[model samples]
Target: MCWDDGMVDPAPTDTGRAPADEPAARPAVRIAVAQRVPPRYGDPPALRRLATAATDANGADLLLVPELYPAGFRLDTDELAELAESRESFAAHLGAVARTHRIAIVAGYPERGPDDTVYSSAIFVDADGTELAHYRKLHLFGDETAAFGRGHQVPPVCRWRGWGVGLALCYDIEFPELARLLADRGADLICVPAGNMVGYSEVPEVLVPARACENQVFVAYANYCNSDDEFDYDGHSVVASPYGSLLAEAGQDEPQVLMVDLDPGLQAAARAHNTHRNDRRHDVYRGPDPTIG
Candidate 1:
């Protein structure tokens, strides 16, 4: 991972809290995941304004933007670095937006490391712009592997408003083991920021829900809209319930913010009903290990 291991900062203290004797309100949480590719070259202020507008429009408790929001996925390492902004600056912008809108935000961007290596990373920013967590892409895609080093450690389960959230980028969702690991670590929800081309829409449409069903947790798959004619994405952003039911989905070839409500109690009930991974035979499942498939 490109993140600094020694940098362990606490979450922002500006988050609003309910009164101690308020009976712990069970307010419904609305989350919005944007399925739109950010403009390749635009003022960061404008982008932040757009994000704030969307959050306000949907009354979102949390907002998610697609991968590489600052820059379209550039293959060249130097190009990606040129597009990368300092974490402080990026967080400041998103934090302002989050604080203004009173919502948490998760955004993906290319990160330039101290050694000058670039890594695909996502940042979870609290309302005050305090960074809750940073997750680097463990599995690189296509030419990305050639450009960036693979992330080694799995990220910690993020805590937000009594919910445990997990993070993953594109291509990572294809690996069931990762999701299972997140679940094992007490994650109740997984947020995926992806860049899906035309032919790969089924991966999110079919595989995402299956992952949630098998893991018994909610999954939100957010993808980019499109670029020029050379790059077209089937924007099938989806939010699946713990039981694998499609709660909400964005249509193909459109820019949209899909909003869905997550119920942790319902997820827990689903897990109790069907303990798939929880009741497993690992002893027999661990066959002879081979590096090359």
Candidate 2:
């Protein structure tokens, strides 16, 4: 189900199963991606409210919010230090909301580590207010490379209701190898929180779907809607199936939460039907120079 500026509809339910006597029944998971910019620096309450409203409006099992959600993606060191917060405190605030709404949340923020380096991060909080996973972005943006230290480790797979979920930040999705790595590691879904400009519409529209089709996994892309009145974002937040079909997409300029039901069985079938695996020749076929490099 999706609620965009007061419009709502009944979401499709998952009824397909792999077999009758399967040990685990494939559960339909509804996810909502909020495509909106966070409040300017030092407005944590407003940021919390936006996230809470998105969670309430969609009633989704998991809510994905964009990176630097608490403080507008600040590049200056002075600004970052002024706005950064402890991971524990930020998780507490989101945890309270998750507990109140009985839903899980994936919120992004700038984390000030003990070493005094700021890292772009996302925290997964369950309905019971428990912090499940913390994914620090591995690939940093252009200027971010100079401002923030890159994370060295890939985050663990997020498990909810027996589904293996992967986390990727903005530029991370641009790398096909990253998604392929996640798929190889058993990730059924990849959630990306991005802040893309007007020119990058093709990323979500073309590249994201291509990534889904090639990897045979679902992708949820949440992008910032508007920022600073000077920049207009392409708010094409989308959910793509493993078949590379767009399941849901939001408008170009709006604060919307799009909900989509995901079924792993469908993804598996799509991969099998397309012969994406059977057709590949890893040993002999060499990809283009850029792909190899």
Best by lDDT: 2
Candidate 2 lDDT by residue in tens digits, 65-169:
887777766677888887778889889888887887888877778888888899888787777889877777888867888777787665545556766677788
Provide the overall lDDT of each model, using Cα atoms, as 2-decimal numbers.
0.72, 0.74
Q: Report the lDDT of model 2 for residue 204.
A: 94
Would you list the clashing residue pairs of candidate 1? none
Per-candidate TM-score against the hidden true structure: 0.84, 0.83
Once superposed on the true structure, which residue ranges of model 1 sit more than 4 Å away at CA?
A: 1-27, 41-57, 286-293
Model 1 over residues 1-293: C-alpha lDDT tens digits? 11223434233222111111111233456789888854554446435544654554467788887776667555766667677766666767677777777788888877776676777888888777678878778998787788776777675567677666788888888899888766665567788888777888777778899889998878888887766433777788899888988999988877888878887667767867877875676656786555657
